[model samples]
Target: MSAFGKDGVTGLYETHLPVARLERAIDFYENRLGLERAYTNDERRVAFFWVGGKQSGMLGLWETGTAPLGMRLHFAFHASEEWLLDGCSRLRDAGISPLGFHGEAVEEPVVIGWVPAMMLYFKDPDGHSLEALHVLPQPPDRAFGIRSLTAWRQYAS
Candidate 1:
């Protein structure tokens, strides 16, 4: 009964964030995170990076100078369990702290029971919360709540 049919939406294609410095943001996303740069506009003070692939998803960074109060936004990128698990060390090597769901420094990804997904959180150069997430191969258990992977395994057993 929808005009767009039953297909609905597939996934996020693009996301934009405001940054205080374009070059610094570019270094964090492109050099540190390993995202491929798709395009950049020096005049418009914006840049775009390919997330997974050229056709998969894109992230746009706009240099808006430093805001007085600063508005922070959060977004997640689809990742494999292996990447999420190993990202803690990789992030630390890059001088970034891998964080848990509660915003605490962590050594491993945390499980969001409602979504039943493992996620690793960190901040970009501009303080925008970024996450690498991978859905678990299990049924959702809302009562389980958010916990570390170790706790989740123990609870499941």
Candidate 2:
């Protein structure tokens, strides 16, 4: 018997990122980003936050003894352009600048050249790459396909 149903696959209730300092990450997520710290497990060197008042979904930070610098990994979250600007302002106030901006707000809202959206990338305290993005115009219609023939074969075969 399988529990899987029409929903296909379940999404993660929480996501965790390892860092060097829990306190700093907590301050960034809670104070700057306006998220609420829900729980902290000092023994495990873990801290959690709840965003937008949702308790089930959480962002977790893990204090590690040794971690690489300069963006060990990159991830993104969706937000409005206003939120992106506000977040960017807060990060700038804290002495951090985004990597670059992408999408429509780059002097081209919508055209044959670029899509309608904006992306702001930055690094966390431990140098993990993060981005906040907003979609302006809706995407064009298209049939989805694997990027390469090898990918299609790997999935089909």
Candidate RMSDs in order:
1.5, 9.4
The 10 consecutive residues of candidate 1 with the worst lDDT sum are 1-10
lDDT of 1 by residue, 1-157 (tens): 7766657767899999989899999999998998999999999999999999988999999998655867789999999988887989988988889999879999988998888999999999888999999999888999999999988888777
Model 2, C-alpha of 97: deviation from truth (Å): 1.1
Q: Which digits, one per residue and each the tens of the lDDT, describe model 2 over residues 20-60?
A: 77889888877766678888998999998875456446788
Backbone clashes in each candidate structure, one number apiece?
Answer: 0, 0
TM-score of each: 0.93, 0.64
Model 2: how far residue 21 lies from native, Å: 1.6
Worst 10 residues of 2 by lDDT: 104-113
Clashing residue pairs, candidate 2? none
